[model samples]
Target: MATQLIELVDGPLDTGKPSKPKFRTVRKDGQIVKLRIVDADSPNFSADLTASFQANIRRARKENREIEDDS
Candidate 1:
């Protein structure tokens, strides 16, 4: 299987400074899924924003498993 990467782009943010962070979600084949800009001050910012990405991965894995099971 190819390696998957969910990497944070740019260096660590300074807490004293406020800025939106961009995240790069890459597929196992090194293709980029999406680039997301997240607001740090939003409620449940991390969980809310990443939920869809996580769900997509879960759904893909489930589909793959189903396909393999049928083989």
Candidate 2:
């Protein structure tokens, strides 16, 4: 399943804040999955996001079980 990331229409929430939920979407296994990313990639340093983002992702996955939720 090739993943297709949906670029956020609006970038990360509030500048300079690293521990906030940012909306992001990706296509996994031919389905689009929405997420709240709290992690940031690095180019120079390695001390980036923690493991807390997983919880949010897990919850999103659980809440959004169907391919489409018209609610």
Candidate 3:
């Protein structure tokens, strides 16, 4: 029922102030699912993912090729 309305509008139908992301409800695996903003054609599941590790080696290489002595 709700899915049809969403599809007809190609997105949320709400037009309230302070526009924000919209989420809809659906049934998946016998459980209710909240469907948020997502592009089925161009998936972006990693848009909010952070880097695995810092680029320590890259930073070191860019700092200086020669070693400094403080003795």
| Candidate 2: regions farther than 4 A off | 1-20, 40-71
Candidate 1: 10-residue stretch with minimal lDDT: 12-21
lDDT of 3 by residue, 1-71 (tens): 35543435566444333223346799999999765543334333233111111233555665655444322
> For residues 1-71, could you state the per-residue lDDT of candidate 1 as single tens digits?
99999978798533343234566877867776765556658665756456545657888899999999999
Best by TM-score: 1
List candidate 1 stretches off by more than 4 Å. Answer: 1-45
Kindly give the number of clashing pairs for every candidate.
0, 0, 0
In terms of lDDT, which candidate is stronger, 2 or 3?
Answer: 2
Q: How do all models score by TM-score?
A: 0.36, 0.28, 0.25
The root-mean-square deviation over C-alpha atoms between each candidate and the true structure, in angstroms, is 14.6, 16.2, 18.5
Work out how many backbone clashes candidate 2 has. 0
The C-alpha lDDT values of all candidates are 0.65, 0.55, 0.43
Tell me, by lDDT, which candidate is best: 1
Candidate 2 local lDDT, 11-61, one digit each (tens): 644333244445689999999987655444543112224334546677779
Candidate 3, pairs of clashing residues? none
Top-down lDDT ranking: 1, 2, 3
